[model samples]
Target: MLIFSKAKLVFLSMPKTGTTAYETALSPFASQYVCDPPELKHAPVYRYNRFFRPMLEKFVSPDIETLAVVREPIDWLGSWYRYRHRPFLAGKPTSTAGMSFDAFVQAYCKGSRPAFANVGSQVNFVKPQPNGTKVDHLFRYENQSGLLTFLEERLGIKIELARENVSPAMPLSLSPEVEEKLRRKCAEEFELWESIT
Candidate 1:
């Protein structure tokens, strides 16, 4: 997460949405940047509301707004699938070494997901908190220009992005049956993505 105190903006790092590149590009301008201990780095709305919100409100500003980027659902899952396919995770329970994209996504749609398909939901990551805290600005990952324009105008600085922490490229094909199951089981994921104009 990157916090620009002066701008009263906090960029929430939604996993697999290419926030790492934003973090890298904006770190120098941010008042605070949390990039370690994956849990904190990728703290969702609830986590931020619990941990960072109170502190920032007290010490920085009470009007801090949050920004988050969400990717197309299937593409997001594919990133996770390919990421775990990396050689480093070859033998781990979380590895997707021999799994087809269909199997991986089917696992993800399960009530109790297997380790390899346990990537957290993007919908949950940006869900509104009980106290009204929420993502004030949301962007689609595919719309880089829109996000960059918002950031540049808000921060009053020119911006550039470099790809970072990208998953390895692979040909992923999800069978129609599995895809249908995923959409049925995880409708919120699709709904949330579509809602991000």
Candidate 2:
């Protein structure tokens, strides 16, 4: 997460949504850059509210607006699948080695997901808190120009992003039936991504 106190803006890092690029580009200008410890680096809305928000309310401003990016659900899952299938993760339980993209996604839709398919939901990460804390600005990962424009205007800095932590290149596709099951089981993921506009 990157916090620009002067701008009253906090950028929440959603996993696999090109946040690493943003962090790399914006960290130097941010008031606070939580880039260590994956738990804090990728802290979600609820986690921010519980830990960082109160501190900011007291020190920064009470009305700091939050920002986040969401990716199209299937592509997001595919990224995870490809990432885990990297050479380094060959022996790990989280690795997607030897698994087809369809099997990985099908496993993801299961009530109890296997370790390899346990990527968390983006919908839950950005869901509004009961106290009304939520992302003030949400951008689709597909809409990089829109997000960059907002950030540059808000921060008064020219922004440039570099690709980072990219998954391996591989042909990936899901069967129609499995895709249907994923949409049915994880409708909120699709709905939120579609709603970003």
Candidate 3:
């Protein structure tokens, strides 16, 4: 279940799904925000499932609207690759920057992943707000326009996003071998994301 309220909307940040971009664009709307400064950035009443929903509902303004953004598994996985393994960050000779789509697919197939480091664990999933209110808005990262339309229509605000954590610095498609591996590795999540797409 996904949930959000206008008084406090929680961004369940799945790594590399453009959380930074969304946060930047949407900050003006939030009453409080974490990951931003105190002057302009309002802290979350709470960010995660930290407190009971009814308890939060009581405190937050009645008009809060909550939202989240998601992306396709294939592209999302590709971005995860660039974000994690890029050599530029360490300023080394830029070689072996990204894993083969095949190898990355194989690694993702393993069920368990470390909390923040692994691909599937950080992404490929969504977490619900406490007490499980259905999400008011779900945006598709693959279709930024669609997401923007959704938010504008519902929230009555126009948003322009400058995306950080951008991936596919050089846009590359997955090979057939890699595609099949991905299809096989993330069957369940692929199906779900496909439906969303």
Q: Tell me the whole-model lDDT of each prediction, alpha carbons only.
A: 0.95, 0.95, 0.56
Taking the tens digit of each residue's C-alpha lDDT, what string does model 1 give over 30-149? 999999889999999999999999999999998989999999999999999999999999999999998899999988988999899999999999999889999999999999999999
- lDDT of residue 32 for candidate 3: 46
Residue by residue across 32-106, what tens digits does model 3's lDDT show? Answer: 445634312222223333443455567865444555566777777767666655656443332225446556555
In model 1, where do residues sit more than 4 Å from their true spots? none
Error of 2 at 12 (Å): 0.4
Error of 1 at 108 (Å): 0.3
Q: What is the lDDT of residue 174 in candidate 2?
A: 94
lDDT tens string, model 2, 127-170? 89999999999999999999999999999999878899999899
User: What TM-score would each prediction reach against the true structure?
Assistant: 0.99, 0.98, 0.69
